[model samples]
Target: MYTVSQDCTFTKLRSDSTLRVLFSGSLRLKCKNACCQRWYFTFNGAECTGPLPIESIIYLDQGSPELNSTINIHRTSSVEGLCEGVKSGLVDVAVWVGTCADYPRGDASTGWNSVSRIIIEELPK
Candidate 1:
């Protein structure tokens, strides 16, 4: 069993299904500063295959939020639009993880030095 959420409360995801979904999202931390990274998700079923590049490490920069400040996965290619609607109080799911990031470290033990995982199922249109 897995717990999922959006910009709000926690919800559960169904684990009995044959299809499985997984993903991650976060903003680049520039110069040890706090940053807010927003990631949109959706279902990219078994048909959704690719050599998708993973942004494992994001570089942070001051006043750089204006530089392509959004992580977007097309609605036509996956179920992102619908899932986003669900996040805004539309549908439901068994497992979901959304909006995560590593903030700048302030105490050397906390903040931007961490990693977050964002997972969501791929649904068809």
Candidate 2:
């Protein structure tokens, strides 16, 4: 099960300005069958075109307690287009935690819980 702890929405920003995106979340693995799990923060929608700026991949062990992780990205990197879209009001900023099983293949079981919080802030250029 996945839960959103905090969702932050920002007004349209200036396209030429720099910004910072922060993704923080906690995950707990409850499945004994799951050998390993990986988590990361994705930008925009899950299906957005172009390359998505993802945070560093976090690996977790099965039956592990709640683990907290955070990823920080700037607007000038590979996610410039996304930043521009947010600035132009054509897109909104959102953060989500995505996880996948690493050990068993073709396993459709769901025995994990996660909570995520996203924050977007504009920085002076």
Candidate 3:
């Protein structure tokens, strides 16, 4: 699921400027065994593309039935990243998951017990 932050809006003092994007917060995530959960950022309806994008990949290995182990339905955790070279303008910042369904996707939960946040800082260079 993509968590779109409509509240994130900023005016760039210049045209075609760069921005430092960071998406950090807590979330409960779970998926099939050997499946990797990828966390990425999107700005103005476009995925952040570059040599350095705001994305986090966490490889999780859990659940053993034959060993009498219980499967983790969802693990609660947080993510953090700092991506540069993102074009700045009248845009919307969003957080999205990629390629989860292709790898036996499960689900992600958040904004229930805590208030997550995103920050978009304009650098003065």
Q: Which is the leading candidate under lDDT?
A: 3
In order of TM-score, best first, we have 3, 2, 1
Candidate 2 deviates by what RMSD? Answer: 9.5
Q: Give the C-alpha miss distance for residue 104 in model 2, angstroms.
A: 4.9
Estimate candidate 3's alpha-carbon lDDT, on a 0 to 1 scale: 0.57
Task: Please report, in order, the local distance difference test score of every candidate based on alpha carbons.
Answer: 0.29, 0.39, 0.57
Per-candidate TM equals 0.19, 0.46, 0.69
Candidate 2 lDDT, tens digit per residue, 1-125? Answer: 23232345565457665446665544333343333333333334542233454443333344323543322211111112233233434434554334454453211212124434465666545
**Residue lDDT tens for model 3, 10-117:** 655654456666555565555545555667777666766654567665555655747855344443444445444555457677777654545644455444455667
Candidate 1 Cα lDDT to native: 0.29
The Cα error of candidate 1 at residue 66, in Å, is 24
Predictions ranked by lDDT, top down? 3, 2, 1
Question: How much does each candidate deviate from the true structure in C-alpha RMSD?
Answer: 12.8, 9.5, 3.5
Model 1, 14-83: lDDT tens per residue?
3222223343333332233443333333232112223231222232333335573433212211122222
